[model samples]
Target: MTRALSHGDPLEGLPSRARIAELILSSRPPLDTYVGWQHYRTHCGLLVPAPTISPRQWSMLPESRQYDYDLYRELTNANLPLQDTPMHDKVGKLIRRRLSSNTRKKDDPTRAGVMISGWGNYGKTASVCSAGAVFEEQWLALHRCLNPAALPGARDLHAPVVYVSTPVTATPKSLCASILGFFRAPTRKSATLPELVRLVADSLHDHGVKALILDDISRLRMHRADDQDVLDLMRAFMSLDVTLILTGVNIPGIGLLREAMWNKTTRQWELPPLESTRIHGLEITQTEHRFDLIEIDRFRYVTPKQIGVFVDHLTGIEQHLRLLNAKVGMLTGGTMPEYLMRRTGGVIGLLGRLLEDGAHEAIGGKELIDESLLDEIVLRRDGPEQAPDEPVIPTDPPSAAKPPQQTKSTRPRNTTFDDHGPASATGR
Candidate 1:
């Protein structure tokens, strides 16, 4: 008799990739969904669902062997072995190889080095932290989350990974002092950086820490020369056997960790916009059959109405996938993908706004999004508000696109917040 498995069963050669899939056939989630899921995982790491028997007794199916993402394994458990799901079993190995390459580097003591750099909001901090967390779980699962014995450590820290958040005001002295503060609380008198670093290197050497993440490097700005407090601190971490992951909003000054630490062989990855279409396929594809879809007469891109509908009917996995798609599109486009993609100056801080004023005007007894109604929306948004609920005679010619209720501004006067929250500066 074929035993049906509940959770990711090791005995089942392949795990059902998606939680809810086609009734007749069982298989991996579609490729589009996989791509979108990868993007989200790039940001949230283990938070992304991986096919794994969760660390729970009820779901446990021990006799089976399954494959799963290493990051997912690190997140849930390190022991009492379980298996990875099918899709995971396939991609998990590749992901692990990449993770290992970044961590282990090359064995040649001085030859291989590391530098993680990318444009702002490229998901660097999140990625490195995820990597660090995985490495920790892999190496330190036997120990408490944070061992107390290391608190006064000149000793007792045999760990291979170190996760540290470099502060905005970090200087050569402050940076060294920060590491020392972690090892031994700083004195009433601020210990000089040389004093701090000597101890830090000694402590790291004593403990055998292997990898370090210096995140948010843009925050640290101490422009001093080599051998002076500056060069030594930047160069110090590389001396240890630890793999170093340097994260910054943009390329750090002089690129590479520091002039001294720069070596030829570091791997780099730049994160880009996630694919919303893929996400759409994952969450909303199943329901496409429910909709009436004889090939359309004209070309029409997605609309908010369609988005709203997709948001309304989908749930659980479907909903999550759609939201991720929406985010990916927004992240890739500057709000007005409707106006065409040409206007994205690429700086979100300087990106334009999306006003519902046009949406409001267009809502009045309107069929298609006509130019006049759209123009009126633009006018109304740019122009001052008419007396509360007073009929606004739109400057543009009449159109079928707007409903009468829309021109009246049902929105309460002086309203500052949206149904979601205080209005986004761009939304306004």
Candidate 2:
């Protein structure tokens, strides 16, 4: 269950310094793997509720009061859900199906292989990592429950999910070695490529791995010999009926997998760029798609609701605050939306950092975050501002005469690095 710290606690109303320190000291990281999931909902962090507190109630408390700081600390540290769109949910569903017990023959055109391609930071890694983590945990739990004898002297026990990222200097031998290392296979200084591949395939078979995720596959600098070796290894896995998922910012051309006839068998999905921007209660088209038409003199951004959720996660103040309202009110007209969006380019990774930094600044003082501190933080990262009169999106109530068009940017990308994919099969 997603635990919510109680705001109704009578002690919360008290101003105990010790109470504040204890809560801060008690803040610890969530259990990584080895965690028990009652169902899929409890397994993934995406479904966890965002921690919320009343901003109005928070500001009324003096900073000297432990309660205020305690709230501030928890709000700042809260693991807010990265709002998953319908598309992300669909992709996750596809991966889940791949992990099913059903198997396809090598010649079966419906082989379970997929490629998630998108711009950097769009949440590609999150979806795969979450799915892989949950599936692996559930599989381990099931294994021990059903095969108790297997646990006592289980030499055949192996992880079901293997995640690896392409190294900067990726080669077939090094890549195989990385996979073998994950299974704790003894390293032979002069092991041949075929030997390493055999070790990987045998270990995966022994452990009963059902899925593999190769994230950042674009980083593989394939030489002629390395290319052939990779193809051979992939073919071997395909022969074993292992499901493969590849994620990358810029996927290699279909030709890289030509020997394996990958394009004929693999499914591909992409995160397109933003299509429209919401400004001054009006939705304006930025492009038919990110690649189509000319660039317009309009702001490129996320919807009010999308950004609003993040703001609420940061402040825990009021869930009702719009992006502009929070900016002007909390920062006291410190920064403008145009500058903020342009600097971060509406990337969630950068936006999250900005809000977190601002929270830290506010937590350092008696008052809520002000313009000066926020400006300092922005200036240090984004440098001096540009376009002084960059039109601010007015938060004025929209006219009911005609409702504005609401179009969401469907194109997304992964912006942060997390340990995931087919290279490492470390069971938590």
Candidate 3:
């Protein structure tokens, strides 16, 4: 029942809950229970209806009917499959780095560039957006610094960080509008590519942003761009001279990225799933059985003793759960546990769902994600219906071998519903 956006409107005229309340609570009722009914009135006096059966009957309604109705409201609101995952905290460090670096030395002003490199549903947008309050605060601060005379409309350019996660129906114009729109800055009437490029560069120059993050760029380009166009874009950016961070899975044959940076070298960083050490560090205990030890070599700081302790704790927990599964069952339903384990191996990426499912099980005795639960944690990623699958094992490939970059982040909330990716509910 998850509602699809209808002609750009997610709500399809099913009387909103607010309206339902408006129809019901019209006037003062009987003197006896009136105060109590008024106090409990929902929808903020918005919906109205003459209860076919008394309000008492509504309360005494069968549990099955109440559950079904609860689902109806949820699906109509466009809720995702898995909704419990904490927004990943990836953007904080990057944003801090850019903010601090921007003012330390004032060179010619430029736009901030940052890229959150990873697979889909891996917190690319949530990285910066979860703490949107902070971004708003930073924007206000920078807005105060802009001197209008020296730079006309520079005040609007100060809101530097914006989250752009729209993957479907993305065009250059709309994308430009979305970014400029973030600052309440103006764009040319046409919002043409050249015009947008000019305005973005100038605005960036006036305000002095250090980085610009264009996450999920893998999906947006104007289909099959040639190297020459890429070169042109590179040259344009060079004039503005802001650090540009573009993220996406590696694409073959398309040299737009390589061509753009032909004369310049851009730093490339790979963000894989959370390593096994971090997972082990959670310190969750297992009821019974032992866990396995995954070697650690990718990260540099942790010591061997710390690693061993973490492994012991983590494996103990995993083994305990596995044994429970042997007696009970594994987390399976929407996206199979085997599939998630295989693709997302060792990545604490699924930590959110794992915790959520565990919590649900604690309360309801559900073995795995069910239809209703799956809708709770899904983080929707868009693009190709299917792509070549990645290797099942987490082992590294040969130095010369190239592992195809595909989605390594999809997991199910429960077995009850289909996946639609995670979209926000109500608000944050």
Candidate 4:
């Protein structure tokens, strides 16, 4: 055998872009599965598998359709990593600090609690949940490796962090009830506020609850006649030496207790996407420290590279590239960004919705996701009455032009000059 000059290992170093592309197309997970459109529709509260289809029919649909339907069924499924913006990083740090402090020997008596307030879809709740999930995962992993006897009573049963959503217009009683329910602590249906408070406090301590996350705090109103009851309940929880995290819309009620616990001069931790001026009339003390999410630059549209990164993260790098080459094409690198930003005002939720709807329309027609599909989706979402002035790009397949979901009636007959319109209908 001729001594084979060893061809240097072809597989060495990072795989070539073409090789990766081949792997993506060959992967079992289809490109459509990871494209996040269905999740957007579900988030917007649109039903998936539509009401017309039974579960059997849904299951019988092609794999691609099933995948989209599954996404629609699970709207909150979009759990993208916190964007690496300054504000998100700051929020992450604050969350880590709060979580770590739960295990500290001496509580920071000088500091009251953390309040994370931000505009809608600014990731306040997601950040908190991510932190809690991380802590829980790490704690559980460590617990699994250690001996059961090494930990004291109930370590296996109770988590280090407890998350609770504040009930809308939450009175002291309702708030306490939600907390008690979280702990599964027993209480009479008619238990008074004081009794409930005492029971909850004891339960929290006994269960070794280290941190309490009260989310959507804006829902809890302080306008009740007996606001002191709410104050007292909070004081009781604070006395437990557990970390307190209150997060919600940047509303006055979010930090009512934190303000009372620490003086106005004391710094508070706030969520980002805030204006330079005072936010929601909450004073920023001289010492006020805030973790803010930077609003996506409104003037500059989201670039295709940024979107590709997002999709790659959500789905996979290989899948993303495949979509770009196969279905997304030049649109991924074109004026689609400006068009989308113009329609959505760069709102994250709207952007997600547009992508989601566009993805489905593209898949249905077995074609690329293009500007025409995006414009149609936007028009349908924003207002079906108004049509974009762009030259129609023929989104729907030639053989299957989709009928408008709803048609506009001819000018409501201008009721004042109606030939037989308003008066005849009302028998006036």
Backbone clashes for every candidate come to 21, 17, 48, 4
User: What is the Cα-based TM-score of model 2?
Assistant: 0.55
Q: Please, what's the RMSD in Å of model 3?
A: 24.1
Q: Give the runs in model 4 whose Cα sits over 4 Å from its true position.
A: 1-87, 107-111, 142-156, 226-228, 252-332, 378-428
lDDT of 2 by residue, 330-388 (tens): 52123444445555554445555665566555553633444455567852333234342
lDDT: the better of candidates 3 and 4? 4
Q: Candidate 1 residues 147-208, lDDT tens each?
A: 43354634364545554556556567666655544444444456665676677777666655
lDDT of each: 0.38, 0.50, 0.39, 0.49
Tens-digit lDDT string for candidate 3 (72-112) = 43222221221222223334655566545553545644434
Please tell me which model should have the higher TM-score, number 2 or number 3. 2
TM-score of each: 0.38, 0.55, 0.40, 0.55
The alpha-carbon deviation from the true structure for residue 189 of candidate 2, after best TM-score superposition, in angstroms, is 1.6
Model 4: clashing residue pairs?
Answer: 37-356, 87-292, 272-292, 272-293
- Tens digit of per-residue lDDT, candidate 4, span 1-428: 01222344211332334543453354232111111212221232221221123334544557755554434322212322234443455666776776676556474542245677655655676666666656655655666734333345544335456777777667788888877776555679989878887887776666566667787766654556544456456655776766677777644323353332212243333334335446575545321342222121211234565555433332321122112113322333457555664665444445555655655565435325567766676343332222222211112224766787886777755567647535566666
